[model samples]
Target: MKQLFILFLFTSLFTSAQTLETIFIDNFEDGNAYNWESEIGWEVINDNGNYVFQGTGHRWAVSPTQRNSNIVITGKFKIITNVFHLNLLENSGRYFFGIHEGGVYFNNDETQIEDVQKEISLNEWHDFEVFTRNDSLAFSIDNENIISYKNNTGTNINAKLAFECLDDAQIQIDDLIIKREQIVYNQDAKWVKTGGPLGGIGYDVRVDPNDANIIYVTDNWAGIHKSYDGGRTWLQKINGIYSRTGSTNDAIPMFCLTIDPNNSNIIWAGTFGMRGVYRSTYKAELWEFRGNGIPNVENLTFRSFTIEPGNSDVVYLGCEWTLFEDEVPEGANGASRGKIYKTIYGGLNWIEVLDADALVRTIIVDPNNTNIVYAATGIFDRDHIAGSGVFKSTDGGENWIQINNGIKNLTVGDIEMHPSNSNILLAATGRLIGFSREPDSENGEILRTENGGETWNEVPVTFPSPDADDWTLFTYLEWDESDSNIVYCGASDRGFYKSTDGGRSFQPTTYNAPFINAGHIISIATHKEKPNWVIANSYGGGVFVSENGTFSWSDASRGYTG
Candidate 1:
């Protein structure tokens, strides 16, 4: 059942970096273990002639083979000291490489700190390597030249290569390999497609601060798309943003897109029931409605809104209705009418400033005090304690303050500043312990304040969190218009994070949580003239672009494909 093609020129089986794209090669003579998680007890032994893996003590072995890579697992083992350790996870922390009775060791995902030991061991069946990409990580035992290390810890690597055995270690693994190194983009590749009225769920992407290829992208079910060519090719404007409100209808769901940092064609559109917001004086090309003129826009659900990085016609609208279970509207528990709206002359006119009870998500003004704003709070479905933290406004939006002192699990999922120290603030929280929506057990944190929110600190997330399953929900946080210590966080589900030390520590980034949803990441943008050209928006994974900032990322939706 084998045909020899002969011209395999292959060779690169681990001289450190010359891979040839082979995702897996488990040579256990096929005796079993095919599904691979070996279930904490590993066996499959044949001993000397090979087909190995005999375990004892705290045993375990896994490899579901997650994605993003430059990978290299290479195997053949017989250990002692730390005996046999091997962990993997890129972009969400923890990427260890081990063998220790007190010698040959490694640690990355930037400082989970096994600290890269070295005692050298090669007493018999040797050979072991562990390679990574984008910020290096190399570890070997009987070949590929022993230890060499480096770690950025996050560029979105994918991991699931376990094999534990903590204490009395005497393992014997054999001939395994997992390779990944193949990326060939560029057939005019800027992700080019702009093709259809495609699938749906692309959250928000605006790009066109005067045309870096004129993009627009917004779709819950395909509401607006207009690419003057950056995303290759597409057009589905939705004639004024679709609706039949009285008959049959389709396109009109769009989540978020605010544009107009001084008129990039003056945009704004956040619809998803109650059409509460829409206006595009030509850039997303033609769409009007404007939130039914906000007479306290009812039953609500406009999701996100913010403008006024110094008056983009002064905007701020974050609406969402219904709070606390039984669909309370029967008395408006904790009342927050219209959730918070204020459109000074751009969406015509409207005002309802602080209806604060949570569900705001992001609204950081203060690029030098446009009245100093900040509105982060969240709680996707009403109960995780209704809605949580962060709401400061030194008078601009009039009045508000719940600063969330020294923050810790307060739902608030996004807020940034430090494009040059706007008093240095960064909040991208996580919480939902009760009535879970799945942060498994409140996993999310990156809170810092240099006196802005008056004091807060948590910033140390290489992301390998799961003492029991903290699901990692840091929605979005950006810093790097050009790099203020390079911070970036986006994980509605688990797939983006990188901090060069401004927020103290962070590393799991390479943005690919199974391409979105498995990694959620609601929204993120960069490129205030190409800050390495980044952009991410995915609740359902559409629209991802990282010219370089996150190292490499693509799929800027190419027209929301069908």
Candidate 2:
């Protein structure tokens, strides 16, 4: 009886295995691929006597073999220069598995399915496999599963295989094999949540005015987070924050976190998307929608926020009016410019103080005088180039005037005042690649002003030679409190610069550990008491610390979970 039962089980297994069959296979040993349709940058090439398909530039090659469902694709790929993609074309849509500079991703149509931040070694061969079962697709690299996603947009049909590479990418593929596999669907299977890797686009970090242990950070998408233990651990503080409905995101895009200089409990936050400003009166533990009189909150993008040094009720908000074809204001005067808004009653009422043609990105209130204020104007992308300079107001946000005299580029990003000298100031010109492209004339200029924006002169800083038509910008400036002459500036493309003779001249920092030498530093903070202890933030490299001054750096982004 036992032998008979075992024979029945063996028959059942054989019946299931018989459904899988090979559909198409290619080794390219003969150095010919007549069945593949090639584009301009794709060709069959011999590598060390092993023939393979090589693709360069933004081009693709299609295979003659086609399958609808329950298909398996196995191949070996190597990126010689940049990145590549394997595309599955369907009648209604397409799916792609691509390797990018930062990592790998899977996308259907234009929507992302999964993204993994990994640096794949270049010029090394790696095995990949993709399996499709109904609305589900499973992908693996080197026998290790990377991502498995289920698409609810119906089953992809009339599938054809294609190999492609992105701009300036040189990729090679070999040992292509296709099979028709019998895939049994597991109806009870569901996706489980696993925590993703830490670190993201950290826009701003602020320390508590009274206590050094309290810290707050704003993410581009994760709203606001706070740490009471000096960034060793953080807890999400997005209590009243709300993202747009049906956007598949629960976190709001928060930027420009400002803590009141006199009141540590009062903090203000500006947002990136249409969401308006929020005020946190309880030290960032809870928030409230405080933007009441700001016009067009649904189409406004706030870039900077500042509070009066002495008065907690007075604040400023820098914003850009996002242009919408169907929702343009009745009388926009043919331009969607940026505006500056001021509120004296702590965000209860706001009035537009200045209307400029460029995005108002940074607003600074004079620390010594409450009546003096400065607004810096520029944008990431826009059509008009007007109002790309700095503005000064002496009547406490009542009136403003342009102050771009002797400035090389009017596209100023950030303006800073000297700690003890109000007459001494620094302005960093920035780049914004918008609808109307601006010229990449120079690698961003750091302008020094001795007469408080009356006139400016370039800071004679040495920078790396730029690529042809490369646009760069400096995004931040930091001053060492212990030594006012020691200054630091951050750039979008050239990293960090230090100046010992105040802001007269500058030199780049040594590209030491934890720094990728590619620059892209955005924000830097210097301790007032411990001048040697500093923190710098990079675009994709996370955070770095320099305890013994800015000579050496180490990673300080271990606890970040953005």
Who wins the lDDT comparison? Answer: 2
Highest-TM-score candidate? 2
Candidate 1, residues 428-471: lDDT per residue as tens digits? Answer: 87644443444443666778888888888887776555552256
Q: Against the true structure, what is each candidate's TM-score?
A: 0.32, 0.60
C-alpha RMSD between model 1 and the true structure: 21.5
Residue lDDT tens for model 2, 67-170: 55777789999888877778889877788888855678888889987898776778889898887765666677777666666667665434778988889899
Minimal lDDT window, size 10, model 1: 1-10
Model 1 residue 117 CA deviation in Å: 14
**235, model 1: CA deviation in Å?**
15
Reference-based TM-score, model 1: 0.32
